[model samples]
Target: MNKEKWAIVTLSQDGVALAQRVAQQLDDKMCHIYTKEKYAKQNMQVFDTDITSFFRSIMDQYDIICGIMATGIVVRAIAPNLGHKSSDPGILVIDTKGDYVISLLSGHLGGANDAARLLAKRMDAQAVITTGTDVKGSMAVDVLAEKLNCVIADFTAAKDVTALILNNEAVALVNQENCELDGVVLPNNLELLETSRDLEEGKYAGVILTSMSRQKPEFAIPSVQLVPQKLVLGIGCRRDTPGEKIIAAVAATLAELQLNEKCIKAFATIALKQNEPGIEEACKQFKAKKVIIPDAMVQMVQSRFDGSDFVFKTTGLYAVSEPCGYIASSFGKCLLEKRKMNGITLSVWLPEK
Candidate 1:
């Protein structure tokens, strides 16, 4: 499920029953039902404070918030606690009678729009989505970015491109690297392009760029650059190496490759180095997932690349970075075969389409 933690809350007696029903439909491990002390049942949690305070208190704790009361009540309770769409939790509102499920806040990036549709199906209610792209049956750029595990370089440009697509204006799709769009059908307004070089200046209303490189092609029209997080970095470092040095080395390597650091999806290493502070700190600084490659997998894949006798003698594996990166990327394309600097060795891998 996209939302790991969900809070189903209501202020009225009727809402409590619907809230409990919603809680039943959701994953029990991730769902919690809450109501005021006067209306709360034995199974539902009672709020110790006011409804506004209770909503504000749990805003950051849950990935999704479902309100069963009036839409205005949910709005006022969440208004002060709202943040940017990128960081905010998905907010959905269901009527007390369960007639409509509304996508209230942080729709695309937060997955509220999808959640509303799914929840409405389970509740036998209609999903009320007002986003222009959804209403017009056009592709939402932010939703597409989320599906591709990408970050949009310019939010304004993304909005413009999405608007153009909704209006059925000509838009260009420039896929450079790392985005798996093999069989995916794009919007009718989007003209699929093999390269930006073929794009004529000012011909299209906007451009949707999918890339991993830091350097992108210049377009005369409004452009939205989608940088996919597809790079996996496998690292081998000496014990007790300071995190600062490891972070610097990674930054330097990414700069040399001319790739955006944000594109790093994970930091992979042998299980032995997984506990190293340097590796852990680098993962934290880059906000990437930590992938601990077991020694057996490394051993199995070591023969595919150049073997290092010294590494095998020291770590019981032929090489660390290359095998770890290969396995971490699900045995995909190897971008950078092991590069060593100082006592550290590193490799980069990208998942093949």
Candidate 2:
């Protein structure tokens, strides 16, 4: 994950000192301090523009906006730009005295709550979190996705399910494979069921874990499907293959197999092809990280895949895609078998659930 960009904004002279202190802790590079021209000091930028416009300008530029002012003032200025929690930046407010740190918006998905806690500790102030999930001691689906490094399917649905849990409504975790969560292998839900069938359809809320790309009708309940980063793609292409072809092949394969691109955490290819433009471009396009498998490891899994004799003689391995995919997945088996496209070969792997 990339480092979050933060902005420390001050409206009053008293708040300027506290803002600078927070900015100093956040570092000058990732965090910038902004203040009204009247209150601006050395090392901080002056807001020559309207205060509301200033917040509007940084809505998309910064990931977290910390305001040293009244919560109402900040809210009114930022209200117009506010959209969904999934897309908005974290909004936090602190008073001029720096006594309480308030998480004003996007408390979970955008990490305002987490940011407030850290900032409160640094400022020695109270962290005022009002999100229902925290108050009710309910499991937050978005936070779960963050911890597991997975993409959530149906963001709005996830929010609804979270609401149900926060309201003290019963929800069941259908532990199909005993999928371990952060090494807590034990079941934690009050109503644990072996399968989704155990739930009485729409009458109950449920959560299911899977690597498959979701279809809306898969679950009957107001539930969140967490697509675990279990699928990995191993790709190989002849030298000079255009990046477009490589990316298209991978995209089409995933679409056909109903696999979410977010679930594909890594892209792997033989070390020789690590610098290949096609492999590099495809991974970049999908925002997935890359893994270069050594020739020795590729050779180990080579016998498991069927390969073209010409590819074998040229690359020293019978196949690059299949072997590298397995190796990148920590030797996990392929969920989708090896496939050929033009000069490229692609295969998909999923860790054992």
Instruction: Choose the strongest candidate by TM-score.
Output: 1
Q: Flag clash pairs in model 1.
A: none
Backbone clashes for every candidate come to 0, 0
Candidate 1 structure quality by residue, lDDT tens digits, 36-59:
899988877888886778888998
Candidate 1 runs further than 4 Å off: 1-3, 27-29, 37-39, 42-57, 238-246, 273-281, 303-318, 339-344
RMSD of 1: 3.1
Model 2 residue 341 lDDT? 89
- Please tell me which predicted candidate would have the highest lDDT against the true structure: 1
lDDT of each: 0.86, 0.78
Predicted structure 1, TM vs. truth: 0.86
> Candidate 2, which ten residues in sequence have the lowest lDDT sum?
182-191
